[model samples]
Target: MAKHSFEFKKKVVLEYLNGEGGTPYLSTKYGLGSNSQLRKWINAYKEFGDAGLMHSRKKECYSFDYKLHVVELYLTSEVSYQELAIQEGINNPALICNWVNRFQVAGLDALRSHKKGRRKTLDKTNSKDATQLTKDFTIDTSMEHVRELEDELLKLRIENAFLKELRRLRLEDEAKTRDLLGSSTVSEDNSN
Candidate 1:
């Protein structure tokens, strides 16, 4: 179903309350889904005033069970994200999508909260053993490192050769210009 604005919901609820017409007639006239939708809005308006008609703008924390339940519901049913959000009292549909994605990737364990920050870098000193940091730091002579260094050296060599060629060309151009100037000066002297 299409999302209705706060003003539209308020107008409909007020219209119903003001005896403009019953839920069925007003809902049809306004092209709303059904009387049930109108009734929901009216109930919300009665309970929370204008705020009830508006979409919630808060970041609500969900329990692991709740997240699992929602994901399972989504997987089992053909419910859209908006409908799920409405049912779960979640403001953001994207949050549900993310939960489903996480559940798919790592199952229920992924629903657990993770510590925020950059991950710690692996200890490079323990090349010989399993993450054991030793005082004697050894240089990495791995084939992967060797290949990476070789690739970088090859790029530098190519850049150096190109620069040398450019310098040679510039020097040649300068020499030609100097020779032309000399010849021109000699000719002018002869003409004098």
Candidate 2:
């Protein structure tokens, strides 16, 4: 099963603390590993508030800032993913490339691991920029752009054809009117 986010964990912790349900009940409800894990979240939440609950117990050698720096290096420097992986002692070059691509497409938030116990590194500016980049990229690559352009061209072509046909009909009507007037004048002259 996929891991839950810190927000989800915090929510569960809050629910448990509110006396909304028992720990065993929560464990079963949320499909948690054990009752102890639920207890740990409650204790952490009580001790450090929401932030404490979001903190991961696992030791991280790399900080969020460090990961951002690494991603910037890869993007700005055009460094190969394999070289970056080797330099960072990362086993998977493909993972590094994915991180770089995601950063380009989605910004700094994409570099974060989606593990449940991991705290999300939330930076307002970075998050906004990432979101904007994602929006822009999505707009550019979407089929909607092509469809809109096609629709406009079609409308323009239809209008042009309509105008041409209207002009032709108007000219034909004028010619018939002139012919009718000319024949009537000739007949009147003969009658006179």
Candidate 3:
């Protein structure tokens, strides 16, 4: 359903609550799905008052800093996406990717979610890891150490890429196997 402004929702909800009109009338008038939705608004208003109806213009989109931080974690740190998601209290890593892409293309404005919610906190563990990874590994005296770390990181990247490829191949193989088995079973049944 299309979103209505908070002001419009509040007006309908208040009218319903004050018995200026019944739920059905308000629902029809406001083009809401059902009386239940109208009731939810009324209940929300009653419980939280005007504060509950207030909407954040920012819409929970990721700030530019947040997007930069996520990219840093993925690129520099050894943290997995799942681990990062858990640390950031995000339910989906794809959302993070979306934020990253948005930041890359549209800059800061793209990171915003268009909903209001609590902000993600910085992962102290990841921050510490990033610090340690970059620390004292200069271009001159630490070249050897840098090379060693780079080799290890390269190995990890290869392993991660291989694992992803393996998973894709395995899924394809499974699908083909299932198809063959199903066809064989069908042939047997037809012959019988």
Candidate 4:
């Protein structure tokens, strides 16, 4: 469905035409996404009159040959995308521009529509034998377990070092406190 109604678009374009506001102002006032949309509406209204501002729902899919022809016309002539779009009865000018760009970059093969969506994704999980799946899962799980154990071991080592440093610092603090107080409270543990 079109975002803006034909009546709303016509009203906006007419408002612009009647010198009410520019594209930005009218677009903002009416919350019509962007000024480009308003400009498109205005241009459509001017070029094709009322029919241009109307919401065109039926998307016409051109053949590969027709697309190639359009691209050829675009390259060989000095026509703008919008003009060529109108000539070719295409709804959007960007489609022509896309075709031209693809043709320029990758030549004719790019114009042909490739299969849409992720090519059925090779159903690897379903296609594999149960034993194969189990083996893969077991290996992955074991590796994950190994990584987790390594992480935990590293954490424990860090904690142990921190505790040792803390104990040393506390003993030093106790020594300083005892020396300041002139008390010989020997806190040294002889057990290694």
Candidate 5:
């Protein structure tokens, strides 16, 4: 269902109450998707006034027994969901429908409240074992990190030595070339 603002619900409810239009006309005029939805709003307005039209901030957590009771009543009797909701003091009739659906699909376990958030994977049977495992893991990771650092340091040293040797060879070659050129010029001068 599309969630309308409190102001919009009030406006629609007021329009209906003030004889401006009926459910079909008001729903069509305001582009309400379901005409039944407008009737629900009108019913809510009559039953609870403005408070029923407003969205509930607090969520109501129903017990498993209560849910089962509601489901059983809905199944066994000829009561409608809307009537059951009012009888059970629930604001939203859709919640009763949801409960009945869940009960049908997944059995009683589905109606039970589940723990919020993820399940814990670690076993907490022995504190000593947990502490031992944590210590061992830390030691293993530290040793591994030290080994990686040593390997990187060795590679860097080798690279530095190789580059140093290459630079020395290049300097030697340049010096030899300069000396050879100087000798050639001297020899040419002597011949002349």
Candidate 6:
């Protein structure tokens, strides 16, 4: 895909923003490919304004914390990779999807950067054995990962239950102590 200049994107977006034309109309007038690219540029402009409209060739590196947050959002929410990237001001949606895919393939640890070189993958192209590995090995590994997650979830649930029970006991004990002190004061007044 051809990268549009910052000036070009900014002009087109501003024209649309200023009610000169809609994306389709602007796209046609400017000889751009389609309204979709214009829509993305408009969204980026809306999210980050002028700076968002600027085009840069330099690669961006997201922090580990930010990557984790985006990955968690993908895991727990119904938002698609593209929509989440737009909301989070990420220039490329595919990069976010890559993060999620890496997480799924190797868990959170996979999101970390590794040495730049070829890596081993499990898939083999042999026709006869393909289906067997596809169904058995992939499913087995995925299920094992799921079980590990379930175990962690169970531990967290147990800890939460323990904390809640401890809180309830403390509240009950406080109420009992308050009652005893109230009764003693009443008895002293009665005796006097």
List the candidates' TM-scores in order. 0.38, 0.28, 0.30, 0.51, 0.59, 0.54
Off by over 4 Å in 5: 121-192
Cα shift from native, residue 72, model 4 (Å): 1.9
lDDT of 4 at 107: 60
Better of 2 and 3 by TM-score: 3
Write model 5 residue lDDT over 1-192, tens digit each, in one string: 437988899999898889998889999999997789999888777787887788898889999778877887787567899888777878899999999898667666677798999887875659888899899999999998996686456445545665676788899999999999999999999999
TM-score of 6: 0.54
Model 1 over residues 5-68: C-alpha lDDT tens digits?
Answer: 8889999999999999999999899998778788878866776678768887664678876786
lDDT of 4 by residue, 102-126 (tens): 8667665677777877665534555
Error of 3 at 16 (Å): 1.1
The sequence of per-residue lDDT tens digits that candidate 3 reaches over residues 156-185 is: 664576577678889999999999999999
Kindly list the per-residue Cα lDDT of model 2 for residues 1-192, writing each as its tens digit: 327677888889878878889999999899996997777567556655665445455544566556766665565454677567656755445666766677667654565566678786755667779899889889887876785576456445545665676788899999999999999999999999
- Order of candidate numbers by TM-score, starting with the best: 5, 6, 4, 1, 3, 2
lDDT: worst 10-residue window of model 3:
106-115
In terms of TM-score, which candidate is strongest?
5
Question: What value does the lDDT take at residue 120 in candidate 6?
Answer: 73
Superior by TM-score: candidate 1 or candidate 2:
1
Could you tell me the TM-score of candidate 1?
A: 0.38
By TM-score, the better pick of 4 and 5 is 5
Those runs of model 3 whose alpha carbons end farther than 4 Å from true positions after fitting are: 58-192
TM-score: model 5 vs. ground truth: 0.59
RMSD of each: 22.5, 26.3, 13.4, 23.8, 28.9, 13.4
Worst 10-residue lDDT window for candidate 1 reads 130-139
Positional deviation of residue 81's Cα in model 1 after best superposition, in angstroms? 15
Scored by lDDT, model 2 comes in at 0.69
The CA lDDT at 58 in model 4 is: 75
lDDT of each: 0.75, 0.69, 0.66, 0.77, 0.83, 0.80
- CA lDDT of 99 in candidate 3? 59
